[model samples]
Every structure is written in C-alpha cells, then in structure tokens.
Target: MKKYVEIAIVLIAWFALILQLIILKDSLANYFSYFTILSNLLVAISLTPKLLASATSFGKRFSLPKTKSAIALYIFIVGLVYNLVLRGIWEPKGWQLVADNLLHVVVPLAYFSYWVVFVNKISLVWKDMISWTYFPLVYLAYSLIRGYFVNWYPYPFLDVNKFGYQQVLINTFFVVLAFISIGLAMIYYNKLMTRNR
Candidate 1:
C-alpha cells in the first residue's frame, strides 16, 4: 500500500512535468517552474522511506544524517533571509517573487529532511551523480536552443544573449561547482551517519 502511494506520487509528478514541458513549449518560466517542482518531487519520493520511518518506533534505527540536514536547513534559512531582507528591500510588494522563492527553498528542504530522518538507505553512486549532472546539462542545452529560436531565456543567469556567452559560461561553471560541492557534502554526511550507526 505504501509503496503504491509512493509510486503514484512519483508518476504524477513526472506526468505533470512532461505535460507542462510539452504544453508550455516556448515559455521559459513555465518550463523552469515545472522542472524545479518535478526535481524536488522525485527527490522526495526517493527519500520517502526515511520520512515514514522517522514517524514510527524505528525512527532512531534509521540513523539519518545530521550535517547534511543542517546544511539543507541553513540553505532554507538563508533563502528566507534573502527573500525577507534583500528582496523585500528591492521590491516590498513583490508577492509573486516572495512566493516563488519560498517554494524553491521549502521543496528542497523538505526533500532533505525526509532523506535525513526517514530514509536511512543511501544507494547513490558515481552513476547516480552522472545522471543528475546530465539532466542539468541537457536542460541547459535545450534552454539555449529554445532561446535561440524564441529570443528569450528562462532565468537571468542562463540568458546568454543578454549576458553574452562568456558570462553565461562563467555562471554555468559556478553552478556546476556549487552542485558538486553540495552533492559531495551530502554524500559524505550520509555515509558518516550510516557508518556511525
């Protein structure tokens, strides 16, 4: 029963993502919003066992990550601070921006929390990391092709035409660095927690 529910959530999320991608076609904002939600949803599904176990008597047996969850929590906190302090100062009434940023922070934190508390198993490997990297790379390429055809970019950091190829390349480099750093940290943290148990 639980497995079915989990599978259903995963399938529904992917279905929505695919539908949005096909329907939105040229709308960068729509594509990105759906993609982000889909990624978070997939992560949540992958970590659901940890989330459920954490609520039961076997919670302590799961041996969830301390450091990784701490980092994810901090990221959520920083995002909130950025929205309240920086974004608020720039545009006090930017409700849409606030909402969007909040969702971005919340979804990832929720996924991280579930991973640390309920899912004690970590099956990630080099192949998984490569697969994760591939999605972003492919998405970036697709975004570039779409931008070329439609003359618009989804996110400011990815807007090559506005920022130029060199700047976009620099931004991509930083993005990849950030991804690798965070991913390695999480992997190490998970391994440490599991070993200590």
Candidate 2:
C-alpha cells in the first residue's frame, strides 16, 4: 500500500506535468517543459528499486554502496551551473528567465539532492540503471518529436532547428554520456553507503 502511494506520487506529478505541457503547448517552449522534464526524471529516479529499497528494512540485507548521493549531488551541481551560471538564466531581476529556470531546473535538482542524500538507502545496480534511465530517454524522444510539430523546444540543448541536426545529435550524445556517468556514480555511491552502514 505504501509502495503504491509512493508510485502514485511520482505518476501524478508526471501526469500533471504532461497535462500542463499539452494545455500550454504554445508557451511550453519557454522553460516549463525543461522543468517538467527534469522534475519527472527526478521523480522516476526516486522510485527506482535501489532508492526505494533504502527506505525499507530489506535494503539493509544487501551490501549497498555510498556513491549514489555523491553522484546525485554532482549532477545537481552541474545542472545548476548549466542552467544558472553558464546559461545566465538565473537573473531574477530581468525577464523572469531566472524564475523560469528556478521553477524548472533548480526545484527539481533540489528534489534530487534530497532524495539521494537523505531519503534513498538502497544500493543501485545495473538493473536499477536501466529503470532509472528509461524515463529520460523516453522523455527526450517525445520532446524531439513534439518539438518538430510545435516549432518550439523546451531547452536550448534540444533546439535542433537552431543548432542543426548534427550539432543537436552531438550535444545529445554528450548529455547521454553525462547521464550514464551520473547513473553509474549513483550506483557506486549507494553501494558504498550500504557497506558503510
């Protein structure tokens, strides 16, 4: 029952996000889509077996690692730098770009931090990697298709029209690499934590 509730929270959050994007299809280009994507990704990762196990007594039965939290923190930091500092989107005084970025990027990163650092207790593994990676991969594909018809993309990283297909693909490759690295780091972290405890 509790597991169902936890899963429900994740699903509901993602559903609400999708509904918002559908309704605001026009304005979704700005930054809302980015936020939705990131938020949903975080939620999905949180519901993964390794992370969920940490919250259960059974999680202690296995020799979990400690690298999950560190990786999550690293991802959050990189995301912060990418969206806020390097992108120059955190200027709260200007065109509300900062606010938009904060809602879409900052908030979700914060959630990831909380989940990885304080909530998750289980060790991650290859299976956990597959599960955690699925959501973002699907979301990225959906966003690309949607961007084609809508003539709008949620983030600059995915703006193929502007960057050209080759560039977009290259950037996407890098993004995938980053995600994979982070995922592996998270798995290691979780294992370390479990062993230490």
Please give, for residues 73-156, the per-residue lDDT of candidate 2 as tens digits.
Answer: 434544653665346633444324443454346545654655554555574455666655565677678778888988887667
Question: If scored against the real structure, what TM-score would every candidate get?
Answer: 0.59, 0.59
Q: Give the poorly placed runs of model 1, Cα more than 4 Å off.
A: 1-29, 32-35, 40-98
Pick the lDDT winner: 2
In candidate 2 the C-alpha lDDT for residue 98 amounts to 42
RMSD of 1: 8.5
Please give the CA lDDT of all the candidate structures.
Answer: 0.52, 0.56
